[model samples]
Target: MNADGMRGGGRTLAAVDPAPEPPRVGPGAVLRQWFHGEHGVAPIVVGLVLVWVVLAAIAPDFLSAENLVNLTLQSVPVGVIALGVVLVLLVGQIDLSVGSVSGLAAAIVAVGTVTAGWPFALGVLVALACGMAVGLVYGVLSTRLGLPSFVITLAGLLFFAGVQLRVLGPLGSINLPFESWFVRAVQQGFLDPRVAWVLVAVWVLAYLGTQIWARERRRRAELSCVPWSQVVLRTGALALVLSATVGYLSTARGVGYSVVLFVVLVIIADVALRRTRWGRSVRAVGSDRRAALLSGVAVHRTVVSCFVACTTLAALGGILAAGRLGAANQGTGGADTYLTAIAAAVIGGTSLFGGRGSAWSALLGVLVIQSVANGLTLLDLDQATRFMVTGAVLLGAIIVDMLVRRRRQEA
Candidate 1:
């Protein structure tokens, strides 16, 4: 061949050869990205730590084993309810009536077991069924009737509150029997130290296993994966934190049954939201309902499911709260309860704009709110101040969320 022809042949050979892949990122880079990324949970985690330190400094007894255990106990009701709120928010909907629904469920349980001569188990089931029915109604109203969720749930809030009042009737309040098995389990039950430690270990192992499986799956799909070292480091850190928490709690009363229940629900929710096709649809709807509909998602069904989940969890929370207090009263589910649950979900880093949140947000957010309340109580602050502080903190959290969302959009 001529020189030009030979050069052309060489260029053709070079074009046919595959290019080299880029160098994989190391653990340090991965860590940096995690800390700086829009999706990072680091801010809330760090904020929690800082709040603890401040509270500990202000009230030396704030970190006491007894107080910490009490704080955990106090967080249960709101945390459980907030989990439902998180789900609703993830689907870009709101259920303002959850507190009233909770109140109604508690009333049902109290009236059935205490006044109507029904079995305890039956009462509990009835409460849950009522919750489901309320959810179904709300779902149908919002989805089929084309009513706004806010309006529907707002009406529900008023109607359910009236129902709760009617259910209580002349008595207005009823104390639960302290000897009841359910009451004792919710308020006083705790895991043995050994069992707590074992649970922590199992959780750590499960987390690591899932991470490894995810990495392998991504590799198979030719998608980028986290560095193995990053995965190991992340797992190790999580294990250490979890182990330490369990060890501390074990030294006190061990983990509360309520806490365990809350954690289990959060874990289940997280898995469903992250792994299931239904979860993807929820996210899609939250992100853009029109787009999700165009993509063949069952937007109406998803909305209904979310409402159902929210109300069901709210009912469970009410039951737990009744157990904790050993009573179901006129004040069982009040406006304060409603606001606190919503605030906790938002403060825990769930975006009010929806499409971005996790079940863990409920847990984390409730802890922060409860810690603040506990610390203020320890300081002998009045209820008014507590409300003000909580409101301020909630406002701050919303501001942060909006700023982060704007940044993400800009990016």
Candidate 2:
């Protein structure tokens, strides 16, 4: 097979046969393919739209610019954690201890700065280093000692929770100074209106440039390239959506710096997964570890990198959460937090069976989850109702994933 064909076929072998080549046709056909293609985010986008419509009908203010802005901010911490979950899931591993790690980071930073007299930046760095250490240990256990990830993380989860409690001691909670830059940036920092617009423009332009560059490279290599018209169409649609969102948010506090950071992380992850050799090795390992080994991929190193990345991101997410909330407590990154992160990753369309997903899944999935939680809160629904509804949604996503996998295999 040609290199492109090999790459395409190698994307998902854990649960399904290789997908057949898509028919070469016109732009219209490609557009259709974009929507209905397996593993695309289009379905989740549609689901989010439906969710918004339903919630708006029930509570007219749910879509108000102010609430939407708040929603964006509220989604950031879990969204960041979910992004890490996507990486772990893509590599056919699980990290159930993310919540504990995040909570521990928050505790360390809180105590370090508030009690131990450490500088804020130093505290943050220490916390993140701890997270990386956790991941490194987990990776070694899984790769070297041959322990299953599920068990390793499960044990880590309990152990880290104990560590967090010990760090906090009898205080039970520690609050950061509200005026600290870390807290202010997460809680009160909004992009200037002009800057927001400029960011939108830059993103749109970068997207367009990327598409054109890719097409040119493919053409030069004698590979099939997407037509220019289709490229322009996608760019236009993205520009319109981003422009409209910024305009709406501009009416309120505009985009929060925390939101911007989360998005930048997502964009970086998407690019890495799509364009880097490390990413290719990750997918290859997830698709078939033995085959990837035979093909000369450094399977252990790749898995270790992913685990380290996952915990590091989780730590960062915890830092953001602490900043946003202005405190760290035993309940900071509780069971609900990690569960929500995992559910969001899956709901955003990352396959649990592995090797088929996207970085954007983290954003879309968290949006769905946070939107639901926000809408329910607005309606004064009880926590029980929110849990039931979110659980149902998660179950439905898993079912859909299995059905899609089965269909691909049959095809």
Candidate 3:
């Protein structure tokens, strides 16, 4: 038994005997309560459902497959960006430069493909590399110069906007070179429908395998673990969503390349944050930077890695935007992209101040935001009304977060 770092508040840290359960709480009841808990994802989940129900009631076509597919596809860029933000949040940092970083990446890809006669694949890679470089520079500045991310990335927002304008130059936008076969392929391409089936199969197997392995590891460590039944139910539901989405989208546009990119980015971020030792260090540092330092975690390195994650994701998002739009320009990654990304992370229940979050939060949050946007369009809502609604959604999430925090304080 030890207090570790607990100061006097009449509470001391100490090991305790196993406390008996108050009673046998049913799994369903437990889950219900969990969903209502401060850290639970229930509020957002329920809000999403309520939005769908409201829209469906108002507009019969709101739930059409075509519209649904469009919604999912539209979610990609923001989700990709939010995926990066998740890493930054996990490590207790922020990156306002993602908007500009993504724009720069889009510009790089456009220049590489159209101006430099580069293959689309290679151009896209280079664009991502450039984004990583920018992120690394941001990390360096924040660490070495001791500047806050808010100010540093705020500067980046301005600098990258200027650079994007310079790249756009005389022409506002540049279509990729069709003279190059690869460039043509990049714009006018789609994945095979069968690929969706393959993806579903692979995801199911991988999820089950991971669940089993995790349970085994927890048992070996003599700690609480996700129950097998619960895992199966949760995994099954997720699989249904993924498979249905993929199958439907593949049928819609033969599978959007942007959607594929989103999935991969989410998977990679999840792995990086959950399965890596660096991730553990990041979580520790985020939860309590001073405690983590005492425990030998390198605070500077964790912060740097978070920026690396942010910039890298921003780059990937930029490429996706470029690919989906078929061009790049001064406004390549402007508008509500950054707002939506941050909003998604927040709605997905990531704490604004960090210390608790998961990479998959991006997917959940992005989908909710995009779905609302899509629904608004389907309902033919006016631009002003749409803006109001979007703001409300974000504000609602923030309010819920504050309430959750206050409740925790009371407890």
Scored against the true structure, residue 374 in model 1 reaches a CA lDDT of: 97
List, residue by residue over 1-411, the lDDT tens digit for candidate 2.
Answer: 001111122122354656656555676565445544655677778788988999999989999999999999999999999999999999889999999999999999999999998999999999999999999999999999989999999999999999999999998999999989999999999999999999999999988887788778877876767667777777888899899899999999999999999999998998798779998888888888999999999999989988999999999999999999999999989869999999999999887766878899999999999999999999999999999999988887777666765665775
Candidates' C-alpha lDDT:
0.84, 0.87, 0.75
Better of 2 and 3 by TM-score: 2
Query: What tens-digit string does per-residue lDDT give for candidate 1 at 304-332?
Result: 99999999999989988888999998888
Ranking by lDDT: 2, 1, 3
- Highest lDDT: give the candidate number: 2
**Predicted candidate 3 versus true structure: per-residue lDDT over 5-103, tens digit per residue:** 111113223538565333323476446445544346666777778878888888778777777767766788778899888888777778777888898
TM-score per candidate: 0.92, 0.93, 0.87
| Candidate 1 TM-score over all chains jointly | 0.92
Q: Model 1 scores what on Cα lDDT?
A: 0.84
